[model samples]
Target: MAASGHTGFKRIVKAAGYSWHGLCSTFRHESAFRQELAVSAVLVPLALWLGDDAASRALMIGSVFLVLIVELLNSAVEAAIDRFGGERHQLSARAKDMGSAAVLVSILNAAVIWLLLLI
Candidate 1:
């Protein structure tokens, strides 16, 4: 028989798989998500190109990952807003815009960190 933890392990894997699928779907439907993801996809490999040392590598990679994380959170907020009926409530607008702004700030943060660390 399978191990006792097999069921839980399978469930965790399925949930992670679903999350990745959702991220793909979200990237397709959400233009901003797609743009940020494209930026991040480029930045990761570029980091290894530019980052010749461990500290610079950490700075570059960490900053790029932060942008991705923020983008995912922004996508989550957008999905939440739409799921609630895509209403034009002021708070909803603020929430979504703030999420986007957070992403903007994250991009800026990456740039700043790169400048500080690499140049």
Candidate 2:
């Protein structure tokens, strides 16, 4: 019943392909995303070593993933806004700013989670 009319395993395969494309595009276009991904490369393994239990490990790793997710969303918003035009517009600026703020909040959330769990 999906809008694409492609159902069952075909839908899953198509969705996975689209997700991979988005990740590749984001990695190519966004330096911030690249930096965060680099940090995550270290953090995920550290989380595995430092975490005392399943819940703690999941929390640490999940928090790191959240940052990447938010950054992807922020990048998407900025891309859409940019596509409209280069001209300045108050609403467009606000949307971009809000997207940026969301990324910051996600990063802060991850930091707080790691700090709280570790110390």
Relative to the true structure, how large is the alpha-carbon lDDT of every model? 0.86, 0.98
Candidate 1 residues 41-85, lDDT tens each?
A: 898898888888988888899998898889888888888888989
TM for every model, in the order presented, reads 0.84, 0.97
After superposition, which runs of candidate 1 have C-alpha atoms over 4 Å from their true positions? 1-7
Q: Return the clash pairs for model 1, or none.
A: none
lDDT score of residue 15 within candidate 1: 73
Error of 2 at 79 (Å): 0.6
C-alpha displacement of 30 in model 2, angstroms? 0.5
